[model samples]
Structures are given as structure tokens and as C-alpha cells.
Target: MPRKGMRSVFMKSSSPSPSNSPSRSSTIPPLSPRHTFSESLMEENIEIAQSLITKWDSNSQLSEFSNINSLFNGDRSEARQYLNSVKDLQTAMHYFISHNSSSENLVRAQFLMQTAMKRLEKEFYRILSTNRESLDPESVSSRGSTISSLSDFEEDLEDELRTAGESISEVERVSMAAMADLKAIADCMISSGYGKECVKIYKIIRKSIVDEGLYHLGVEKLSLNQVQKMDWNVLELRIKNWLNAVKIAVKTLFYGERILCDHVFSASASIRESCFTEITKEGAMTLFGFPELVAKCKKSSEKMFRTLDLYEAIINLWPEIESIFSYESNSALRTQAINSLVKLGDAVRTMLTDFESSIQKDSSKTSVPGGGVHPLTRYVMNYITFLGDYSEILADIMADWPLTFQSPLPESYFPSSDDDGPFSAISVRLAWLVLVLLCKLDGKAELYKDVALSYLFLANNLQYVVNKVQSSNIKFLLGDNWVAKHEEKVKQYAANYERMGWSKVFSSLPENPKAEISPEQAKSYFKNFNAAFEEAYRKQTSWIVPDPKLRDELKISVARKLVPLYREYYENHRVGLSRECGSESLVRYAPENLNNYLSDLLYGNGGGGSISSSSSSSSSPSRSHGRHGR
Candidate 1:
């Protein structure tokens, strides 16, 4: 629509001359209004059309193939004027078609417009190609920081350039200039009805950049069959590469490209959106679709951590995915990302189920030597402890995959009510896994021949579990209360081990050490205590507690229970027994000898105490003293 002022100007210029005007020759009949208007419009269009040819006739040598000079590079004002001339010629062509369709001026205008578009097409391609580094997505996106409304974008851009001032580097200046040039050309070409040419060039150049970027990031479009056929080692390396790539892809590469596309084609909303879609859609799909392919591959327990890592990477980058691929055309990219997350979550859940099943199905009947930590105990505890690192993500993934046990776990197995929080699901899941291992361990413990060694096996394995939980991220997921409860179970096992292993020794001691007794009775008591203590020590010489803290605690617990009472009994009965006995060896063990014997237990060193030796002495002075003092 022409403005009212333009309409008035056309009307005035096309107004008919007075019929009786003296300047008009009588033979020259007055012209009709239609004829006069058509002639006036044609003349006006001829002038407008003439401006296009005149403006560019001198610059006609600056063709698409001219490499020495750029139409937009030298003078900012001149470039802007060229755009206005093209716009004016577009308006002229419209008027000519409505008023004088066969006019040569329209042909000229059309030709010049093509000439201008060709020049712009060349500029667009040149700017994109030559300024690759300056106009990279990262630089462009960072300059914008966050997308502002399109209406204020030019203002924001001006403020940015103005603020950069003399401190702007040569690359930054080139980038800003290139951006302005490209946007100007895009706006001019689109207004002149050459948007397809401009957009086609843009898509070709930018899509290449995007494709190359993804290629360098090690993202590839692997089919499910290819991924399935891949060896685990190769697939694992790919997964690690993807884990590192997804962050940069979402945060910088794709994000920056979106910003640049939107900015350059700001004049056309539909063009920018479509261009961004076509440029980034395939690369993004391939990037995000990898996890789903990996999930679809042969599932295994060993691959669970990598699957979880993929899931975590996607979940963490979701905000960027949503923001950058928000276009309706690019919804597939968003859906692909979501689908990868879902598949990864499923893989993780499946791996969890398989792991738990493997634990319960463990059929090893061989008991651990000397009641040491079981291999299954070490494997499962180490695995679950690592699972604790992903507790936050697991909570989300496991929200739907509830723990389903045939029978409820024991109350002691549950974390206290105060331990409940956001990660309760993961905590329960991991806790259930540990419980599965424990039940399996229980079956393994029954294989041991000695009931006392069975208790010791349970204690050693559970102590390992507790230590693993405490040392890793599992400590936070399974709270202090859970740890404390398990620790108490370990204590109970240790206590049972002591009671079952040393019952005879405890029974051999007199009820009251200070009671009056005959020398014969004292000798019998001394003889019985020596036999029981020596037998217990000999039997437990090969037992082991691998954890130093638990080992020391168990030693202290046993020594505290046995040592003082034996010390009192020996002190009261020593002289009377010595008087009755033919040799002093009957009152053989000094109180310090008990401490020495206890030190040798649980070390897995099969050496007996010095009870039979003529000289009974402490081999480890510090260890003996510490045990005695305890």
C-alpha cells in the first residue's frame, strides 16, 4: 500500500490539463484521464527504474565473480543506499506491472533486481565462507548472550558494537561487520523477493559447519545394527566420546548456530526457523539418537555405568535442548533427546534388575577361606557404591521402577524414617541390592564347616559392606542411621563368633577367682584354663578380618571379655597352684600372655601362641600393650 502522500503526488502528476489552456495546441486534443494517468505512472516508474540502472551501472563490474572488491565492505552508507535503490526498483516494477505491463522499464527493473540479488548472493556466501572463525556460532551466540525480542535486536546489536569501542579485536570487528553485512543483504534480498536464493546459500554454508562440528565431536549416525555389531570396547569408547560431546553440542554448537541463524534472518521469522531446522536437525538427531541405539544393543551388567552416564548427560543438557530446538519443525530433535533419555533410563533399570537377579542366582557353594570377604560381596558392594554417585539421576529413572520384592525386607534393612528424602527410591533400590547380596552371602556362609567360622564369615563380609558404604557416595544416600544399623549387625556377628568359638574357654574358668580352695582344686583350675585357652587360640589362628578397624575392634572386644577375668583368676590361684604342682609350668600363662595370644588371632597368619614355650613373651610390643590396655 502506497502512503497517502504518494497517492497525492500520483494524483497531482496525473491530473488532466485545462481543456482550453493556451499552451495546448488546438490540434492536440485533450487527453483522457485514464490515458493521462497511465502515461504519468509510466513516466514515474521509468524514472524509478532508471535510478536502479544508473546506481549500479558504474558498479556493474562488481559482479558475483569479482574477488577484488565487495559491495558492502568499503562504505557502510553506500551499502545502505544500494539496498534502498533495490527496494525502490521493486516498488517501480509493481507499479509498472499494474499500469504498463509491456513497458521496457519493467524489464530493466527486473534485470537490475536480479543483478542486485546475484551480488547479494555472492556477498552472503563470501561473508559466510571467509569469516568462518569470526562468525562462528560460539562467537555469535555469546555476543547475544540470551535471545532478546526480535524488535529490539538491532538496538541490542548496536549497543554491543558501540560498547566494544576501541578494545574490540580485529576478529571481533570483522565478525561484527560481517554480521551487519549479512543481515543487511538478507533483509534486502528478501524484500526484493530473492529470499530463496539467500536462504539456500545460508543453509548450504551453515549446515556444513554444523555437520563438520558434529563430526569432530565424534558424533556419527550409526544404525542400530551397526551399534549392535560393535564390540564392547569400541562401543564403550564411543559412549565416552558422546558423553563429552553432548554437553558441547547442546550448550555451544547447536545453541550458537540457532542464535546466528535467527539473527541473520531476523527479517523473516519463517525463514530463520526453517533454516535453523534444516541446518541442525540431522546433526542433533544423530547426536541425541546415539544413546537410544546403545540402549537397544545387547544389554549387560558391565555396560550399566556407561548407560547411566549417557542418561545423566542428556538429563543435564535438557534445558539447552528445549531452548535451542524449540521450533515446531525441530521438535523431532527434542523428541529424539527425550527418547534417548527414556531408552537410557530403561537400559539402566534393566541393568539393575539383571544385576539383582545375578546376585540372587549366584550358586557358588565354596565358602571364602578363613571366613574372609566373598568375591560376590566385593563385586556387588563396589558396584552399588558406584551407583550411589548417580543417586540423583537414579531417583528420577527409578521413580517408575519400584523395588518389588516377593517378601518385605527385614525392618533392620530399611533406612530409618529420618533418612527419607528425594533419593529414597535409589536408596531403597541400592539398599535392596545389598540385601540381595547379603542373602546370597548367607547361603554361602552355610557352606562353611565350622559354625563359628560361618559367623566370622558373615562378620567379615558385612564389615566390608559397611566400610564400602561409608567410604563412597553411598554414605550420603544410605544415611548415618543405615550405616550405624549395619555396623551393629557386624558387632552382633562378631559377638556370636566369639561366643560360639570360645564357649569352652569361658566355661573352664572358676566362678570366683578369690574364693578359698585347696591346692589340688587350684591346680585343676589352672590345668583346665590352660587347655581351653590354648585350644581356642590354636583353632582361630588362621581366621582373618581384612579391615584393620574391624580387626582391631574385634580383638579388643574379645580381649575385654576374656583377659581381665583370667588375670584375676590367675593372680588368686598362682601361688597355691605353684605349691601343689611339681613344676611351675602348670601356672603357665601370665596375664600378659593372654594379650599376646589375642594379637595373633584374625591376622590369617597360622601361628600359635607361646603357651608351650619355656619363654612366653610378646612378639609385637605395641600391639600387645594396646590389646592389654584395652
Candidate 2:
């Protein structure tokens, strides 16, 4: 029979045993004195507690007895304390296992165990493989042994089939409760539009449970059947929550005070790639049409561009961006994308300049603007200008110069024939005239004259051949009608110039000189004329013509001759006006008007020399004559 005092504490009540329960005992031990425990007596109490713990099918009942024994064993306090601690830990572990034994918890526990084991193994290996010679082998071995003992304890717990089975059932119940609680919280969060927060809480709960159960157990393969049984809708909801979290993170980064712009830039680059893929896959054409989304993207991208420090990154990414320009199905998108790319380029240039300026100014030197203007910008500007100038020249050649030559030559003109035959001669003359006009306009009239004279010689030879061809009835075919048409255009252009006031300048040239001009006088006049022509040409020519050796040589000679005359003109017009107007007025007006008047004198209507002669002597005689003929 059970002892009177021990009956309530140690004796079990009649109850149905769990399936696969351990053998039960009918007799109970007598109670010891409450006070006064000797070492031997304490040892006996510890043994009794161990024996009871070993017999009990349920860990909770075993743990209760162990705690009571610990209170009674006062003399073997340390040993009993260690035993009780182990038992308590084992009981707590059992409770947790029982409450969390759903498939989800099992799977999560296994994963957690694996992760912890990996970390432990890594740390163990790191310590074992360390280079320190002072490491104590005994200490390492003791730690290893402790780990092995814990592993064995977990094995023993697993081997207790009835206890393990009961714990598993309890774990399932607890897991279900936990899942319901989690679901309720998640639903609340979803209703409140705090889905991201819910996801975070759920993650923390899962991790805490998993870490607590599996990290110290070192069990690698726990059951996950219950987890597998959970509704997929939960997972889907979690994923949606995760997506919301990502959106929240992006917004936080964008609005945060930190220079998180670099992160945003990286995010934007990723978003472009990812979202573009979605657009393609989902056939979401309307998404591209959304202006607000596009504007947001553009603003984000611009901000990103502004923050980028690396020029190489810009260059590397520019090609990918350029490819987007070809995707023009959505005009608005295309425009925004293109403009963003342009802004990026500008930003890159700005960054490059800033970086270079920093380098240069390191020693306290001033930096120049346009010093680091990108080669690409320069190339684009030059190409645009060239195209524009070429187009203007084409228009002028087609429309203006040739028509004036259609009227019959006046009787006063020498070599006057019935018809100026095919108008080719007149065209050549007119072209020369146009060239002369250009030189005058350029303030390089003297240089134009020399060049024109050379071209005229060439034209004269060509004309003599044409005459020969006509007289011989050879019917030589000129390659294209460009020459005739170009000449007519030149003539009309010259006539237009006359109407515009060039005739007055032409009338000012020395006419019908009685004496043969001295070589020195001719040279001096040519020199002055050429100098004026070049200056005017540089100022006025819209389309640049490559300077030939002959033109350059003529220019030098003209410059030498005209230096004195220019000085005289400058002295009389500029210096004299400055003296009259005061230095301040001269300074104010000189930058604009002085150069302009000089340009006019050299190229304008009534300059003393003919610019047409210079063009006539050059390769294209007709253009030369037409330039200055009027």
C-alpha cells in the first residue's frame, strides 16, 4: 500500500494509460523527513527521482517528481541540481515538441537544425583548423563530448515511442492553435493594410519557434507532414505580403533623408529590367500608357542619374538604354525614355567635368568651362551645323544664281555674240562673280580676287575648248547640267547682291587706267585686296571651304599689302572714332560694330577690287565669277 504522506505526492491516480505505455508499479515508496538531508540520503533521493523519471511514460509527470526530489536532496545539492536541470530541460523540450509537431513546424525545425548545424560545424572546423599552437586539446575534446551527450539525449527522447507519440499529438494541437492565431493576426493586418508588417511578424514567429526547437537538438531530419498539409492560400497570402514589403522598402528608400539615391538607382535599373519583362509577358500594353507610372519611373531614374559617381557605369549602361529608343510602340514611353537617356548623358558629362575639375583644381588652378564638354556633344553639334550649311548651299545653288544669265548680254560687253551659246560661258562668268561676292562679304576680297583670277585663267582655257568643241561640231557631253544650272544660279545671286548694294562697291574700282600698272603697284593692290577678302571670308562664309595652297599664298600676299591700308582704315575709322567717341563708347561698340563694319568693307557692294576674278582662276570658274560679277 502507498505510505500516508507519500500517497498524494508519488502515487498515480487511476487513469487510462496511453497506447504503448511503460509497465506501471502498484507499490509506492515511504516519504523521507522534510528537513535534515545527509549526502548518502540525498544520493538516494536523486536515484529515486532518476528511477521514477525513467519509469514515467509522460515527461510532464516525470518532471514533477524530479522537481520534488530536487527540493528534498539538500546535501547532494550540486549533483541533484545538475540532474534536475537536465530533467527540466528535457521536459521543456518534450513540451515544445509536442506542441509544435505539425508538418510545417517539423519542416521548419529541420531546416533550422540544418542551418544551426552548418554554423556549428563551421565554427568547430574553424577552431580545429586554427593555426594557434596554444589551443588545448582537452578543452576541445570536452566540448565535443558535451555535444555528443546532447545528441544521445535527443536520441533517447526519440526512442521513447509512447512519450514521443503523445508529444507529437500535443505538438499538433499547439501548432494548430499557433497557426490559427497567426492567421487571425495576418487577417487583421491585411484588413488594416499592414500586410507587410504581418509578414514580418509571421517570419519572426516561425524563426523563433524553429530556432528554439531545433538549434540545440542537432536533429537533421524532422517530420514535415503537417506543414505540407497547410493550405496553399496561406503561402500565397504570405507572398503577396512579401511583395507589399518590397514596395514599402522601395518607398522608404526613396523618401528617406539618407543619400539612398544610389540604392534607388540600382533599384530603378533592376525595375526597368524586371518591369519591362512583365510588360512583355503580360501583354500589358496599357501599363506602358500610364503616364503617372512613367513619370515616376523617369523621376526615379533622373534622381538616380544625378547621384551616379562612376562615368564607366554610365557608359556601360548607355547602350542598354539606347535599345529602348527603338521600342516606339508607345510614343509617350519612348519620349520619356529617350529624354531620360539624354539627361543621363548630360549628367555623365557633368560628373566627368566635375571629377576632372577636382583633379585639376587640386593644386589651386582654375578650371575652364567647356573644357570637359563631351566629345559626343561636340561631334553632334558639328554634324548638325555641317548638315544645315550643306542644305543651305544646296538651296542657294538650285534657286538663286542661274536665272539672271538668261537675258541677252548688253552690246557694251565685249565678245558679244548673238546667243551666249548654251549659257555655259555666262554661267562660268556668273559663278566667278558669286565667288567674288563671297570674298567681299568675308572681308577677304583681295584674296578672293587672286583666287578668282587663277580660276578665270582655268575657265578661259575651258571656254576656249568649249568653243573649239562647238566650231569642230564635236558635241562633247558635259557630265551633268550642274555647271549650267549652277552658273545661272550664281548670276541671279549676283544680281540680287547688286540690288542689295554691292553695285556701288564695284563702281568704286579703278576703271580704264591709262598707264600700264607697275608690278609693285599691282602687287601692293593685290596684297591689300587679298587681306581684306580673307578677313571678310572668315567672318561671312556660312559654309567652310578648305583653303587651297594657291588661296593661302594669295591670302598671305594680300595680307601683306593690305596691312597698311587696314591700319589706315582702322586709324581713321576705329582709332579716330574712339578718340571722338571716348574709350568707354569704343569698348562698348567695338566688340560688335567694329568687326561688322570691317567685314562689310572687305566683302560688301562697293569694295574697289573684284572678287569674281579670284574665283574664276580657281577650280570652279563659274561659281567664282557669279560670286562677285554684279
Candidate 3:
């Protein structure tokens, strides 16, 4: 090898010049010159090199080169001795180079060094291949603390490297042994100036493991055109895989590879950094770049959820990304990760804008039947509630994104105790999204011919919104005050519903129930009361309050206001009317009958179900208790 010739040349150059040479006849004898003493030392160093390195040399007649494992046969002492010999040979070669470059022993030392490196190269590859399971990314990561705990003992590498192979039963111990063995070989090779060969083998083997790990994780490199042109179902599957893969790739696969690379090549910072970067760069870039590519694809409402999921996964894994890929050389991976987050956040914001605009632009003017919940109301509230579940994630995403309102949002819409608190951006954004839906609902309510049903529709839909906010993570972001404010609005809408819906019923009763009137007058008032009550009941029977709590509250409020007065008037007029003909028909409803009708009031029973006492009065038995799912 060129190193042998270099060693000889270097030894020749180490010799003193004639001007600086010691005089042989002065302090030293002429027969024992300085060159002679140096030559003697060089011979002793050569004898040490030959004793240790010759048997392993391939060209030796006594022994042919073979696999190091077979040569050692699980003999750890032999393996360690072999490494020590390589190191000794390296020392002896340095002695020869600096002292006696012209000596023939330099050639033998050079040959032995080459033979030792080749054997170590084989040993490195063997240990890596055979112990792959023990040294896998997950195993290595799980044992990270344990592996680090082995650091204080790394100087005693012979004990660790001796335990290599299945003989050491524990996975962690085997991994430590394999790592130590690799490090020992690497240090020997690097010291002997064979670092390139050591690094090359590591890159080839570990890169394949990384690629295979990613492959099993279902990560793939695709062009923008390929991703964009793919169907959403297919793209969504890929996005899901990427979401799962990114976390493992960063935490386990890349992380473990980083630890292993750093450990094996710990003797050389430059080699470890370059080796790890080259091994993991391609897979990691492809892994992190997937989200950005998905973000660039066609934008749609359904795709936004998956996009948010992608965004959340990346945001959660970012700290590990920075720590693991912290090397300046791995900046591209870090950049790729951050870019994915940016594009995902941008995509989410755009989706929000598009969603809000779609709600504002909704041209559906048809009134919901019987003033029941509008489809738009259901769709928007359900969507908003689900979005509310992602509040924390959206908070991070929208930290810098302020809502752009043409007019400042109504104080009633988003009432916060602290104005412009930390959550203002996402809070106002999500609240305004709900506000847009409410405004759209207000327009739809106008389509109702009966003003009473319009108010009822508003009450039902707004109650749904309030319940959605109160029940989710949105409560944390928007706060209790916001929920209470919207809840009060629900009550106001309900009050209006009762006022407009029951005004005629209220007016039909006499000014005083106790007033004594002739039988003719009493019968006429009773007739009017019956007609008004029936009309109001018929009009309101189909209107719905989907929320059970709001439904019950509205029932109690209406009953509280109207039932007592009607019951008192009914008692006052009943005896007088009874004396006249057909009193039961004139006073068609008892007080209990009115309460029963109110009980069934907001069940959304279609086609204005009968107000008669015979109709079922219980709340809708079939309505799902799961408010959002309903």
C-alpha cells in the first residue's frame, strides 16, 4: 500500500541532518552511533508487530485468511487481542517511520496493518448484520439510557466486545457489545488511517437499514405532480401513513441510527456526522417533505381534517426533530420539517377562510319544515364542534394569524373577561366562524311564514351552537363567559319563540278569571280560549329544540307564564259554563292537558301532530342522547 511507502519516506525524513548529528567520538563511542541505537529499537518494534500481526496475514503459509468469527470462534480474548495487535502494529509502524525508514521491517508492518483492517472490516460487517435485531432502531432507542449508562465503562471495551453474538442473551447487552466492538474496530482503523474504509462500510449497511425501516413504514418519495394527480382516497391513505411514519422516523429510526452512528464512530466527530447525515438524509427528507406535498395538493373541505392531523403530528414531533437532527449538516432536514409545518398551517388557514366564505355565501333560502333545525345549521355546528376539538393545535397554528373582520365582532358574540388575551387569535377566529353560521341561520329563519316558527328555529339552532361550545375543548379556548353569553342568547330566542307563538293564547283569557259574568259571556270566553290554544299548539307542535336541556327550559318557561292564569280562569268559568250546554266541548283542555301538549312541544314530530290530550306527551323516545352525533 502507498502507506507503507509513506511510512518508509517519513522515517527517512525523521533522520537528523549532518549538521545536527551527534558526534560519535565525543560523548558516544564511534562503534555505537546514534543511528545504530535507533536501528536496534526499530528491530524490537518490528519483532512485536510480527509476533501479533503475522498469523492473520492472508499470504502467510502457516495460516490462510478466513472469517474473523471462525478464527476467533467466540473467543473474546482472541478478538480483543486481535484489535490490540492492530493497534500495536500501528504503534510499531509509527516507530519505524520516524526512526528507521530504510529498514525492510516497514514493509512487513504495512502488510500486517492492511491484513488487520480487512479482518476488522469483515468483523464490523458481521456484527452489524448478525445483531441487526438487537441493534435495530427501536431496540437501540429503548436501551438509550442503558446504552448511555454503559459509557463510563466504554474504556473497558474488551469485556463488552467479548460478549458479542448470541452468547450474551439479553438484547441490550448484545447491542452494547456490538456497539463497543464496532467502536473498537473503528478507533483502530481510524488511528491506522483506514477511517475511509470503516466509514464506507457503516454508510452502506446503516443506510440500507434506514431505507428498509422507512419502507416497512410505507414511506415513499413522490413528485408533486404524482401527489396532486392522485385521488383523494389514495392521497389520504398516504397522508395517514406519513403521519404515523414521521413520528417513528424521527423518534426511533433516525434517532436510534444517530445514537448508533455517534457511538460507533465516536472517535471521529467528522466521520460520525457525515455518516449519519448520509445514512438518514434521504429517508428523513422524503418523510418530512410528504406533508408539504400534501398541502400543495388540491384544496377541499374534507381534506382539511387530514391536513390538520398532518399539521398536529409535525408540530408534536418538532422538538425531537431539532434535537436529533441538530447537526449543522442536517439543516436541510430541519428546514424540511419546518416547511411542512408552515405549509400545513397555511393550508389550514386557507381552509378556514374557504369554509367561512362558503358559509357566508350560502344561498339556501328554503325554510326548514316546521321551523326545525336547518341542514346548514346542523352541518356548520357539527363541523365547528369537531374543529373545536383541535383548539390547542389550532392555537399554535393561528398564533400569528389574526382574524380579519370588516367590523369588530359583537361583544355579545365573543365575551372574554380579558380583552385580547393570549387566545384572541384562534378564539376570535373560531368564534367568528360560528358567528358567520349564525348570521346565515338568521337569514334562513326569515324564510319562515310564521314569525313564531322563525324565532323557534333561531332558538333551536343557537342552542345547538351553545351546547357544542360548552361540551368541547372550545370551552377552554373561548372560555365560560363566551358560553354563558351565547347561552343567554339561546334563552332570548326561546323567550321570543314563546311570546310570538303564544300571544293569541295569552290574549284569549279574560282580564280577570274571577269576574262573575252571565252564562252567555262565560261560554263565549271559554270558546275563544279553546280556539286560541288549539291554533298556537298546532303551529308550534312541529318546531324543534334538538337539545334536551333547552327543550325542557323552554317548556317550563312557557308553562310557568301561561298555565297558572289559564287554570285559574278555567276554574272560574267552568261552573258557570257547566250550567250552559256542552261545557266540556267549550273548555276543551284541562290544565294538565296543556302541560302534556307542552311536554311534546319541541320533539319535531312532523306535519303538526295533534294538540289533543290523546297524543303522546313524553319527549321523543327515539332521539339519540349523543347530541353531536345526533
Tens digit per residue, CA lDDT, model 3, 1-630? 576675555455555558767653454323435655766765666576566566665556655555232433455666666776666677777777775565577888887778778877777777788888888998888667656646422446545545454554577676776787788788888988999998888899889999999999999999999999999999988888887888888889988998888888888899989999999999999999989999998788888889999988988888888989989999999999999999999999898889988999999767777677778877887887788778778888888887666876578787473767666778888888888899889888889888888998898888777777777777877788888888788788888988888888888887787888878887788778778877776667676777788788888988997889988887777766655556656767766566666665677775444543321222333223243232
Q: RMSD to the native, candidate 3?
A: 6.2
Task: Please write out the lDDT profile of model 2 over residues 1-630, one tens digit for every residue.
Answer: 434443334324334456577544433333344422332343354344344334321234434443234221233233334334333333333333443333243343343333322322232223223311212222222233222222111223234434446644443333222222223223333332333443333333323332332222221221234323434454334333333332222122111201111111122343223323322211112211221121222222222222222222223334433343223443444454345334434543344334323323333222211111122223322322232232322222223233344555432222233434454333333233223322322332222323432232232223322232233212221212433443444344323332322222222223432334544443343344344444444332321112233223333433443334434433333332333333332222212222233332223234323232322112222222234332
Backbone atom clashes (below 3 Å) for every candidate:
0, 76, 1
Instruction: Indicate the residue-level lDDT of 22 in model 1.
Output: 50
The TM-score values for the models, in the order shown, are 0.87, 0.19, 0.88
Alpha carbon lDDT of residue 239, candidate 3? 82
lDDT of prediction 2: 0.31
Give the C-alpha miss distance for residue 63 in model 1, angstroms: 8.5
Tens digits of per-residue lDDT, candidate 1, 269-380, equal: 9999999999998898889899999999988999999999998888888887898898899888888889988888888888888998899888887777789999999899
